[model samples]
Target chain A: MTDLLPRSGGPDPASAPGPVRRPFRDLSAEGRGRAGGRWRRGRVPGSLLSRVERRERRWSAGPAPAAPASRSLLAALLLAAATVTTLDLSTDHGPVEAARGVVADVVGPLESGTAALVRPFTAIGDFFTSRSALRAQVAELQAENDALTDQLATADVDTRRLATYDALAAEADDLDRAVVAARVVGWGAAQTFTDTVTIDAGTEDGVSADDTVIAGDGLVGRVLTADSSTSTVVLITDADSTVGARVGSSGTLGFLTGRGEVSDGATLDLELVDSTEVPDRGETVLTWGSQDGAPYLSGIRIGRVTKVYSSLRDSSVRVEVEPSVDMTSLDVVGVIVPKGTDSARGLITGSSGSSDTSGSDG
Target chain B: MSPVRTLVTGAVVLAALLLQVVVAPHVAWHGVVPDLVLLVVVAVALARGPQPAMVLGFCAGLLVDLAPPAEHVAGRWAFALVVVGYLAGRLRPDVAPTALSTVATVAGCSFVGASLVALSGLLLGDPAGVGTGELMLAVLASVVWDVALTPLVLPPLLALLRRLEPGPA
Candidate 1:
């Protein structure tokens, strides 16, 4: 029974003292036997075999090791699959929408409270900011006010004549394009692209998609999202925003794109057709519209081109037009509610700007 | 603390997340914002060991991921939070108490977490630095807020976690 068992598998001291079943079992297993250790007489001894194996391993390996292609390809494929999976899993509005609703419910009041709390801080900030520039602004305003007052005092018409003129003017029906009023409700809160704002008026409120939303002297944005109590008005100066605006006293038609409103140095891009011609600083830009044609909210004042970029090499004007909206200064402002426009719009989820998919100007 | 304390710490993390979603956007500093979730994460990591910190991070990150306008990755935050928690947990307990260290931990967690999120954006082929500056501003403000507020929050939370522990004190 003991002889029937292999020597390595069982205690078999009796069987032929068993060649120990020790080292270098096969020709394949014993490659370069003398390669690992110091050999006496050019032959490897069993005593030095393990050390020889160690040296053999060290000798075989070189530096520029190549990873297995199958594994690498599999890893790359897996990575690609994971990336796509993550994308599919990551980009969704459901959680966000629910969270928004819950957050709005919980945070709305808190925000209102915070807004209230920040009032004191705001006052302090205003004090500091106004202190530095207040003197200059006051002097400028006082000079303008004095000049205007003098002009008013010198050019007083008779009350009867003025009344007659008012009656005729009132009956004539002002033919110039006018903007309707809307209210701001929400901000886009987007990280990269911020060419949108939410206004509290929609098609039901005589507001429609594509109807321009203006704050005061310039365009705030176009109506992208129009709901009953809200409409996301993409601002004109958003990085993704663009408009066809007329510049200067010459009414030069040019494309006004947003050139990242950085710090107090907010600038609008005014790309003009004629490279030779450049808009002057403070040249007002208005939405190119009809003067007497059907009341299609046109010729609406957009902004004043502040800094014209004419490097003599760059074709585009890259004019920095300061918007009339005074983006940061606005607490509440007028949103143009163009007349005859329907406010009743079906809720379109995720589709932006109704007619124009890409909401920016060409 | 005990294992029970650890679980309670997780609940506290959830509570903190809810508070963040409900309140952080409103706490404006010069119209910039703070990240409340990051604040609580650092706080917990400071109080607990790495395992518990990782758990707190995961739950908090998931909650933030579940928050609005942020719906894409439920697990990415888990991955990020674990990393933050692991790293922060390794800090000396004494360092956790200091205002500077507290703010540093919060800022670090927020930076790491937000950077991880940007990785997702990069995968989608969006431009690099998308929302990063805003995220940084938000983290910076939150760190300031954490320094301002964590001292107020940490002791009470630690007491609460200790009390929640099932075993003897």
Candidate 2:
């Protein structure tokens, strides 16, 4: 049993080595010895053996040093990446946008080409599905036109009041702003970075960063970054988006923040500034307008209040508002550029001219 | 590297980029598009070495950021891709990986890549960054897509790379 156990601790393995191990000593003498001859295949030159030993020692020491050029390159790449991300996030408009513009100038054409190529297939599918809808839409428009024409005959008595209202409405449209029409060319890249869209009209078309974007219905978003021939718009529903809004009838001031998309629907949270002025359900929300109305213009419809909640801990009133425009189907939109000092002159001329024409017809 | 090999690598990267930009949106499901550029970079990194891989990853990421419709903060993807490229390059193909290992590499790299993007964005105070709950879902989805696409992408890419470069073939 003891033999089967294999001489346990008979000699410390270190001291019980069969041949005397002098690891540090020169092996040349050992290599020429009678016993070492069996292990040695041939008489290797001392210089060659020493070289091999030295090479092994260097390798066992630790990791090899990286080339200075490679280290510099890595550091440079990291620095560049960090700088760009910081600039893009911090600045409203910057060189990052310019670089994107240049790339967009190249990529936009390719995208258009692809869209043109694929349109026929999409058109064919839409043709089959939309014929009835198109017919119904045209009939509805015709009926609306006929009704408006009949109303025009009885408008003389109310012409002055209607003109005042028209002037007010026009003023609400970013103070009768000079508008530039743009078409949505693409949706936000990859779904991970959501709630943005690209438009074909860009800086050259008098569109600038922070300009207000709107569809026919209501506010869409503001221009996030602009280039020469294209611009990116961060939609009102983007997670990063927030607009100062006023609630209906009462005009209670609040901030509408994007809640991103949920399974039920895409929603916005309207948190009142006063918290005491809690908006009721179904109250319309409109942009409260930032100073100069740069990003979000005043009177742009945001949404209507759906559900209101008052938090117990913070005493903050938060209301969930469903967006007015269908974010999923944004196509053609317009950028609102503020008119110059002549805005007042233009408004008066337009309103007076409309009133005179209405009075004469009556 | 030989000029021909360099040119071949460039052409491959350009093609991958074009495909990603031009064709990805049409095929995207639930806002998640399969990242072909990531797949191509990792495959190249595994076949090549870390040095060129890092540079290539940076270039590809930069292009994606600068291209139309890339509205997120610039350099976020570049930073993420560089790290992924370096990691993938570490597993030099001295011996061929089995199918299981290949799948693991794809999943692992994709997970790391997505996490890096989220983490870096969060660190930078990027408002566009996804919430924590959504981040996990996005990473998992990215991993699934990457793993599924890897087999189709990597083998052919490696063979082509070997043919392009002088020493390997």
Candidate 3:
């Protein structure tokens, strides 16, 4: 009663408390006996409780623990991964590169064998598909031939002059360097996230990185990476691929970048040097080449200007150019091996669908 | 992991990598192909635990990085797949998901994986010029392909994994 009364401003309960609030273990024997055990006395079923307990146990089982050795091994592997990535990205050749070379050596034969096995089936399919395509092509060529026949009669004298220039160009191109013929073994998959192709020709056959690769139509791309018996070519339509280009009759200087894919209906982006000078549509584009014509020759046909637009970043004008070569159906191609190689002086040919490298230059 | 199980896993991974390199190109549309290697990692992680899944992921990634036609920085795929393997391993408690749910998981994980790959490439300042828009498109297409192919790939992979290590469950 006295504790319940206010002291100064409030009552002091602790002073007048009859039972102290102590822990269960600290409670006096009489207090412990008097405390209610409601949970034990509850009417909950033993079976239900057991079930719940079992479920809790099952659910509470944490993930499996890895052995210490494995953990250490994993840590070591991760560290090795970091080191390998750094070495691989920073330089060309390393232990990782040696491993890659080994993989290429081992897997290259398997890939080639698989390709050989699959070619027949694909060829059959292509044969069926090309039959209809050939009919349409024949009709188209027939109409073009008739048009050319009339034009040829009228321009016989001019044709001879153009033929002479064409011959001179081809001779000069061949005289400058020899082109190696190689077969397209495989195309880059979506998993690779690159627009590239693998060819059977490699360093053993004089194919090296940064060499110019082309098809019968025009400029295909350049060699990206090469193994002893295999080489990877980054197509001109690859998003990362860039080539110095000359646009139209005036040969306006610009550079071409790939749009990542050809089947997706993407076009090459051509950024010209002078934004003020916009090239007309239908103008031919050619490779301006580097200083020594190593990767790209001075007069390789690239594409043609289709549309023109203003540059977003600078005063230079940007235009959309359509690649002249049909990138999707590259079966056979040529690798322009520069002069001064240990291989044959003329050309080092590899697995080829046909020998189309002799005459075709730009 | 038993030696046989490890060997079988290795063989499966090598087969998937081979398919990715050889057969995937034939079916690829618009520069997007299903990530068969990632699918293997996810399936194995779901069956097995994180430790093995992550190690396998690292090895698979390294192979992809070192493989020919890979122009980007090495170990990029390894890093991305490791994250995916970890995420997939987090679902170990719910080991046996429904078929539809499994499809969803693959698609969802593929999106995360692709985005992670793109982000890593961006962080590394990819010299290959993988643009954001193009990468996004590739990711979307990849998710579609992964979802479509999950039914075919996941079940067989899960069965083989189960057969290899029956004691885990």
Interface RMSD of each: 16.7, 9.6, 8.4
Best by lDDT: 3
- lDDT string for model 2 (A1-362, tens) is 11222243444333423224533222322232211222232334577875653333221111111112255666777788888888887786689877887888877666556555665665565576468867987997899688768767765645654564465366464255556777666665433445677777776776778988988888888998777677788888887898998777666888887854522257887878888787778667878877766887778878788898888798877689988876754657878775432211121112322221111100
Any runs in candidate 3 off by more than 4 Å, and if so which?
A: A1-83, A92-96, A124-176, A190-193, A274-277, A310-316, A338-362, B127-130, B166-169
* Higher-scoring candidate on DockQ, 1 or 2: 2
Query: What tens-digit string does per-residue lDDT give for candidate 2 at B81-107?
Result: 887777666654321334455567667
Worst 10 residues of 1 chain A by lDDT: A59-68
Pick by lDDT: 2 or 3, better one: 3
Q: Which stretches of candidate 1 lie over 4 Å from their true place?
A: A1-134, A140-212, A222-233, A259-262, A273-276, A288-297, A314-316, A338-362, B1-32, B44-101, B117-169
- Native contact recovery (fnat) for each candidate is 0.03, 0.31, 0.26
lDDT (tens digit, per residue) of candidate 1 on A187-296: 32232224344444544556555665656555666665444444455566666566777665555778777743323445677777666677677566776643332111
> Candidate 2: where is the Cα deviation over 4 Å?
A1-76, A83-98, A119-170, A189-194, A260-264, A290-293, A311-314, A338-362, B1-23, B26-30, B92-100, B128-130, B155-163, B166-169
lDDT of 3 by residue, A16-38 (tens): 23223433111221111122211
lDDT of 3 at A31: 17
Best by DockQ: 2
True contacts kept of 2: 0.31
Model 2 residue A262 CA deviation (Å) reads: 8.6
TM-score of chain A of each: 0.49, 0.58, 0.64
User: Model 3: what is its DockQ?
Assistant: 0.19
